[model samples]
Target: MILVPGLWLWRDPWLQWAAGCAGAIRAAGSQPVWFGYSRRVAWTAFLRPTGGTAAELVRRFLALYDRVRARHGPPSVIAHSFGTYLVTRALSDFEGARLRALILFGSIVSETFDWGTIVARGQVTPARMRNEVGAHAAIVRLAAALRRFGYPYGESGVTGFQLDELSRSVNVRYTGPWLADSALARYCRGVWVPLLRPTHPPRRSVLTLRSRELSRT
Candidate 1:
């Protein structure tokens, strides 16, 4: 699975939402790998700074995630809204890029996104990393006010993911208008087909220390 779409989506009627999340990950049998954008990306080239085009879509999403992990071993991403900042900068600036699960929606990255060095270098696993927040997402609040002119973007889909530690990574808030095609088919059949189910099971541990009375500010 790997959908990754967002931006003008070449208008013409809109609401593809990664082809309705690639038809709900092909009716939950998986095999998606969508990833478009060879052209037609205008919202003024998604708010300027297009010289590299977000590092050439993070080098074509790490060359289609290493040619689909050299034939299906580690592909599971959902991404939206500038493809969730190009899949969090290709899993935080690449290095043996791996992913067995991740889902974001209408995100614009930068809520101080280190994710503790992408969860201490395992690529993805804070219980498989989901983030679907949408507190009245006005284009992620104009990409958090264009991040004060430097423009990397923020608001974490509007006030989620301010991680400091102990992040289970499942933000999941919603209200409306996150490009709603019935809220992306009810979050693609109730939260990304049961979290990219191959019999689910990803509740990892070990990164502690975020208790400040369960903080959120």
Candidate 2:
């Protein structure tokens, strides 16, 4: 199994959350690999998240995945938060490549994210944490769409976007709001940030894109 951590965290997670996960997999008689990365930008944890960071994470994951696969055939993957995006992006290159499983924890991926398009050559077990949050306002949804997926700005009345997507086993669906519907959500418009920032760049513009996803109960 391969373990990955979230944003603002170093790729080398042996001393962090990866430690527990790696140990569990080891006790299960399966070997675990710790991926390494330096989430450094602007020399602060609050750096703006950019696509470059995600891309780099994906690159590092692929490197280790390739090495592990060469030896162990295919390795299951476990990732949390932004690391989830990294794994998703990497496996996408080998769409439909069968592995043991792909587990995600506290994933902040967008609603429209195509989980079915994940890397799996066979029926892969998917799991995630699910907490329910109310639907978002039209403007909140609109701003998130613009920021997360880079949707073009236009007249869109989409009030809520919800998906209880079945994920690869070993994880949970993250239920967090993309934008808090309050005095801030009203004017927190035109938000944008590169993947290089802290979470995912939607929030750093005015809020944290690594937001509590608006989930369907």
Judged by TM-score, which candidate is best?
2
Off by over 4 Å in 1: 1-48, 60-66, 78-83, 87-102, 109-131, 135-139, 142-144, 147-193, 198-217
The digit string of per-residue lDDT tens for model 2 on 1-217 reads: 6766655433344454556544445544456687755656311211233446545555667778878878766666666545655565566555645555554444444555544544133434343222122322333244345454553221111211233444322222223333222322122111111101122222232233434343321
Error of 1 at 53 (Å): 5.7
> What lDDT does candidate 2 reach at residue 69?
76
Candidate lDDT (C-alpha), each: 0.72, 0.44
Q: Which parts of model 2 are misplaced by more than 4 Å?
A: 9-13, 41-53, 119-217
Per-residue CA lDDT of candidate 1, range 1-217, in tens? 8777767644521355566667767876667877777445534446763457667777888998999888766888877777788788777778679788888877888777888787788888877777878743787888779878887878787677877556845676865344546467666766677776655553433343355435653
- What TM-score should be assigned to candidate 2? 0.53
RMSD of each: 17.3, 17.3
Q: Which 10-residue window of candidate 1 scores lowest in summed lDDT?
A: 204-213
- Every model's TM-score: 0.30, 0.53
